[model samples]
Target: MIKILIVDDDIGICKILQDFFEFKGYETCIASKGKEALDLAKKEKPHLVFLDIGLPDISGMEVLREIKKSDPTVKVIMITAYDEEERIKEAEKNGASDYVVKPFSLEYLNEITLRKVYKQLFEDLRTEHQELTNTYGQIVFTLARTLEEKDPYTKGHSERVSQYSLDIANELGLSENEKTIVSHAALLHNIGNMSLDDDILNKKHEFTNEEKEVVKKHCIVGYEILQILDNFQEHALIIRHHHERIDGNGYPDNKKGEEIPFLSRILTIADAYDAMTSKRPYREKISSPIEAVNELIKNKGIQFEPELVNAFINVLAKKQIIIKENIQ
Candidate 1:
């Protein structure tokens, strides 16, 4: 479970925040003094801290500096009554993750907390890449789960897409190495969504053209983030082109036809099928598996490669994963 440290001199504010966060399923520790806050931070090693600028003992700014110096990974959100620009700058300089003034809304605070926590978790995952081996799939699944936790609408989306992609790879008789690459790439296809704002991600209304452009940037972002890993260079390139169309009408780049990577084509079919059938915030309801498959067939040779789409449909049929009556 995630732990939070609340450091404020106001007894009432501490009580309210502690109760609110605890109710939200976080383990919280409270401290009214800078010395106590530092001690708790050192002992508990909390993932997040809500600190007041006006501590009775040491300056909260000093505590922030001390905590960050000890462990730069610990996120600190500074709370202050004054909205002075100088103080805000200083807190940021000392590694504060965010600043909240008095009279802040708990809902807004929770939103900030969630964003910081997720951002930190992604960073940690990236660091863990260096230690990866045969356990790579487990680590990738953990990363996907963490991403889904942040966006409830896409829960199980990555895993399903990965499975679909693997099925296609197997149907095409891909080598074991190729299948591994396809599986990991599918699982991490949306890893870039981690950088998107919660508002844009969870918007219930249709996205504006600008929002669509912003959303399209995820492909590049995911590629850039994954390319740095030792053996993920190919995965990065495949992810970068997963949105490209067979006829040249897709994504960050407009690579057309056979120019698009083969694994990426497989991922495109799997991803589009899952998106069509999955519940989205803007959609009234999800399409049936048959409807999704028909859509894939309709778009084949245009949005997706014709042969891969046929192979994918056969894979679904053979696995009995779709409704029998729906297969035509």
Candidate 2:
């Protein structure tokens, strides 16, 4: 049977909701105070909680926090009077699953309850999806680390790129989701290098035109490999375009300007900065940090998005986030 907890200080309101939910085939519990609500939540462990924002013993927000802390998966639907937008927001941030203002119609409450019940019914599938996502992320990380182990010169390059990309993304005020895409794409940017010959990756001398052509194929190779995983389809596209130049002079497809993915633009600058500062098979010596920054400025609009270069410089100057030497 489905269990629902209704927490309200008003005895009349609690009785009304209890009768309504119980009539709808739910086993209902009620609490008229914050402490009582928390204790009931711990003991009953209901699948759903309709929590009020105001309680006599402690604030409803505190009770919501305690309930969530104990069981994050519990669906907490907050109850609030009108003109409590701030409190509603607080409840949401504290992990309330939904909110219903006072004096709501029974029909509306039923709709909300039905939605919650549906979620509860499919909760196992959601858990499995989350597990798969986590497992996939671990696999990507292991692949990146293995790629690095293949070439000592580029060791730790992906980590530095990911860090730099995150700093730049934060500076640009990108959304959390965008930052996540940038982070993962940067970490596995060179995953295609895993397919390259060891001599190509580790050569101490400059590559011939033919060798350079072969070397650049890692971008496409990485994209193909990453895209094979469902979780990495979008990220694979970013990785593929990371090597493309802003002027459309880059490899494979030669996509240029705004044609490149936005996060890819951010990843490009980070990748270049790290590559310059790091020792590469083609470079005689690692460029100094100052030199790398200058290169980014010089190549702006040619190799990277001009705005991203400016923001990246600002991130470096303002945040004091250091890029360790020999990253790329």
Candidate 3:
């Protein structure tokens, strides 16, 4: 049986969840305060967590963070009052597996707990991945073209990155919004690369300190270009920070982990994977598909959202999407 932990400040809510989930064949653990909830969760190690946003001892987000930190595999569903859209989004961003608006019917709750939450999470992850891609695509073409005139040797690099981005985005079952932003980000990830001297771009040799510095600035350059466009404002962070290192060693600004927006992180996985797998102007080696995915998984949380890395894996396993060459 599935083990579920219900954490709500209200005794009534705890009773409600216990009865409902137990009736559905789940073993249930109940806690009426956030502190107790955290203690119970640490002890019980439930398969799923149903958490209320309002708690007596600590805020729900605080509890959620602690729970995930304790055991990153447990899926947490935030239970919030109907008017808490801001809280809900915060929960989503803060590693929440799903959220349920309060005053929901027990039957609906049961169904969501058993079936709907994972689907929602998968869809949302995919959507964000796509949106980031599309946002990057809008700016990279010009940068790639600029580089092409001077380097000639790396004519299709950005375009190929765009293609690889699309493939991975679809493989992840990314939502329409995610595919859109990321496609654009992939295309423009090299905006800074365009400004490097032709000798450096087409050098076919290890980059000098100065050349590498010039190449690393594309992330910031892309961010600057898109930061001003209408609707582009939404994806500016992604463009500016995609190249950031997981260990805070990557170029431009060294923002690490969650400090980097999800869009930028998503693009980093797609861009880095493509760069490793596809032939590049200066590098010609290609990793096997399995090898590429393993590399992405190895970098999760440090460089990508752990959930996204898992979802990307599942999407590939399920093969649940189709990709068309043209975005129209």
lDDT of 2 by residue, 29-116 (tens): 9999998898999999998898888888899889989998998878888888875777778887998888888788988989865687
- Local distance difference test, each candidate: 0.89, 0.85, 0.74
Worst 10 residues of 2 by lDDT: 319-328
Model 3 lowest lDDT segment of ten? 319-328
The reply for model 3, stretches above 4 Å from the true place, is 1-156, 163-175, 315-328
Q: Which tens-of-lDDT digit does each residue in 226-298 have in candidate 3?
A: 7765566656777788788667877678888777777676677766766666665667756755677777777
Better of 2 and 3 by TM-score: 2
Q: RMSD in angstroms, candidate 2?
A: 12.5
Quote each prediction's TM-score.
0.58, 0.57, 0.48
Deviation (Å) of 313 in candidate 1? 0.8
- Expressed as tens digits, the lDDT of each residue in 121-172 for candidate 1 is 6787677665573366456557667989888789889989999999999999
